[model samples]
Target: MNLTTTAKPIVIIGAGIAGVHAAETLRNEGYEGRIVLVDRDTQLPYDRPPLSKEFILGELSEADISLRSNESLTALRIELKLGVEIVSIDAKKKIAISSDDEILEWEKLLLTTGSSLRKLQVKGSDLEGIHYLKTLSDAKAIRQKLDGIQQVAIVGAGFIGAELASSFKKQGKEVTILERMPLPLAHILGEEMGEYFLQLHQSEGVHVITEDAVVQFDGTTQVEKALTEKGRIIPCQAVIVGIGVIPNTFLSDKELHVDRGYIVNEFGETSLPNVYAAGDCAMWPYRGDNIHIEHWDHAVNHGKCVAKNLLGGEPISYTAIPYFWSDQYDHRIQYFGHTKNWDSAVLQGNMEDKQFTYFYLNESGVIDAALLVNQPKNALAVRRLIKQQQSVDSDLLSNPEVNLKNVHVQENEDKVSY
Candidate 1:
């Protein structure tokens, strides 16, 4: 698809990974038309995964996590408008109004607004020491505050909370994670895996409190203690809440189809013609369901996939498999595929050894997902099995002698029926 030089610029909102990748993909795909990337943040687009780990641990500087430098973006002919936001959009006119009231005309529009961190709304929520890690500035504030505080309390046991707990423990601070669930990550990874993580944190001298919810925070200026629902009081000088995030859909009008997120097809095309949305803010069709994934890899791939559809030609369907990883206390957790319901979870190794793989299978005995803990070598093989949707012997999957690469059962072979 050839775009004329006189064509209007392609306007992409949100200068995070999704928007940056889309702009870069447009240039790489030979689009000569102008491309403008707008973002509300003043800082250059940077990697977000490190904000809770390396950035908080002081191992990586601001420049180190930058996705692209100004010179690099300039060379690609991608104009970046930082510290600007698209307040509203007129879908019929193909124009967007910015926060400063500057109107932008676009040949095509891509919304990658991403997500915002959810805030705790209990008593004393306005305390000065309570923080949420979502952006660079948030991480910077937490890092700066860590210098004067020793007792650190994390409100959730999700990925962000776990990673922050690991970072805080590394600094020799008294870290305690308060989770409302009976076992951390039980809803996602099941109770067995959640118990494994609970042990992992306790073994590192970090206090793990489960089945308790913080009802109020008691402090005059800063958070001094957290009051729980079960009459438990946790004394802490600082708090970090990582409950979850909500997709940014404030710019979408009523005319646009909106569910949990901006509903889009496999091509990433929204309800409005010539308008598209990707990343966390868009819910695209996956398998048989419309799901929204808020991970770095999905955002990058979804942006690139949507960029191809921006050009008026054959549309490319987004079919990338979901993958995400977390680093906590010398152990790396890598997950491939996505499934909220699984019939059985087959364990590959001993959980006590801190090296294992849990294969989640559906009722059809097909591999739905796999989680690897400190087993990097089996990641590729597990991903392939899940992508192939192959069924294997559960005994072989649990056997330490059997390699994952050779566990694929062909037709006519007796396999474990779930």
Candidate 2:
């Protein structure tokens, strides 16, 4: 069935960066069909990255981080449904039942339901002061309670945890981080770079305890202390958990292929016809691997790419480079491309100077990914090199004097695309 010819609305669940971008793309691409953008969140779609940093630091307001204004969404002719959960989807009938039992029939369904925060089920988790930051409301609650918070304990030393540590320390609160890994971010950035970040926190006066997991939280009415697996006790008036998130796949039908996430092909098409998925909830094919990236850049590009395919003409494969950034204290961290494994990580510039880049090279010396610390100028060049998939001289990549733009060999069409 040609989706454009149908009068039924194109229903997109989850009004996040992905869903909002998809809705706008549909309209901008000249699709005249009705569009419905739904989300359980009542607030207008807002940028999430700041929730851990600027939002907590009071540098950026709730209105400042909003992705789109009400007026913009209205002008696009997109129907906004807030505070409504998509309870169930009837694949055969092409209908969605919401939490209110309202039915929405669609010519094509796009699942951008995104991901949910992974909760720590430790004892005393229900205590009043323990928090998880995933939404604007979560940040607001934390901010409102900050005046009474003196000591803050952060669980999990991931991006959220690290950023929270930076923010809390800046707020003049005694901050402590509990990480299960001996070296935080070692799983992704390798131990060398991880140690650099671990020190980054310590240098800023934040206490970090590694190789320890929070087994329990203890308090009377509110969390006053955290008990770790290593028998260490951390005292804190407030605790923030940022272990990571699980892809929201509750609305997915059994007929839809599901792996770590809702599985989609290159064009974001799911197993069921007229049904598609993207963003954090959808895992797409990349370099012969099915992967899910939970980041703003990927979501925005993925949503737009999928929207074009939904218009029913020549299909476009989703191949945008995966990117994500983090702000910790005064440092700006930017990473481009994605790779689970690399033959080597070549470090250029000095970490002690607080500015450097780590290039991950494949077995054939091709640049797979790069991590830039306070070196925003090298970002565009690194991205171009990774996408080109051309071999680079390790000597040149490791030298601080060498320009990254001049470090690559001629691009080969036969190389594997990122």
Candidate 3:
């Protein structure tokens, strides 16, 4: 638990973006210590953003999605143990026990285990054609099985599901999306935006059913149909479940506080002094509340922050605003900030015009987040506004004539709440 020690190797669990970037960051920060990166995935750690989109559509290969090259890993002196699972961690001794019963000790530990895709628990979920596109293997399986497949049933309308649906539609496969919500992305983007997503999918020849949950998958040896609780059966040759993910927190101990993720401080330090976490597995502070952001950008930022702080310098707070983007059909949806408790949203531009931006406001009138559709420039403006925590008039935000970059943020009377 000695945070100042730099003699022992840094053992990083999970060779995803966070873990790999942390190793890179530590080297960049001039730390010449040993670095060990481990993961259960046998393949090289790769970028996951393309798994459902370009990768599934056959536009990108596994090599294209890789975050690091072999040359880079060797240059950074990162010892990668692929296909190796760390069964448990001995926090007191700073030791990680692998699935193969190999023990490794560390001066500092980083838990970037990320999360696992939530599996469908209904009957016939184990069928051959049912898929969950979380890993490279999953995407490869789906790509191979998609050969000669006619229809695909998507189980959710979240980002992953929507992206997969768009990919399938682009690949000339019949896509049917079953969303339990009234509209796609309803909980995150609200009704109107969700409806726009519905229209976008429909315009691309994808079928959608709202407020429907798949009760079971029906097929003999492979998934052929999805039976919904609403008494509807969707016929398809394959099924992809994109319900969500659960954070990997099984390795947490009494020294590490575990909630939805491993609770960490602003510097990514867990309750244990020398142990830290980042990425989807780390829940750190966000404006007074603890939030675990699962986006790729957040992972990169967190890894750098943890590396900087782990070097025993002035602790750098990991307060970078979370940003995420999804490309579906002709639209590129860019969002910044966390919109957990947004009270109101104002939309500018015409949804029919195919260009619009939505500004999310907290109860205190401060801009908390923004969603821009095919408006990349406005995304920068919104990012600045959110970074400044500016409270602008809702009318100005809603006015199409007013340029958001020029619109001044007002100090609302609700400033006391924050």
**TM-scores for all candidates?**
0.96, 0.97, 0.95
lDDT of 2 by residue, 118-156 (tens): 999989999999999998999999999877689999999
Off by over 4 Å in 3: 1-7, 408-418
Q: Give the TM-score comparing model 1 with the true structure, all chains together.
A: 0.96
Q: Listing every candidate in turn, what is its Cα RMSD in Å to the true structure after a full C-alpha superposition? A: 2.0, 2.2, 2.8
Candidate 1 residue pairs in clash (backbone atoms < 3 Å): none
Q: Across residues 109-224, which tens digit of lDDT does each residue of candidate 1 receive?
A: 99999999888899999998999999899999999998869999999999999999999999999999999999989898988888888989999999999999999999999899
What C-alpha lDDT values do all the predictions have?
0.91, 0.91, 0.87
Q: Model 3 misses residue 360 by how many Å?
A: 0.9
Prediction 2 global C-alpha lDDT = 0.91
Worst 10 residues of 3 by lDDT: 409-418
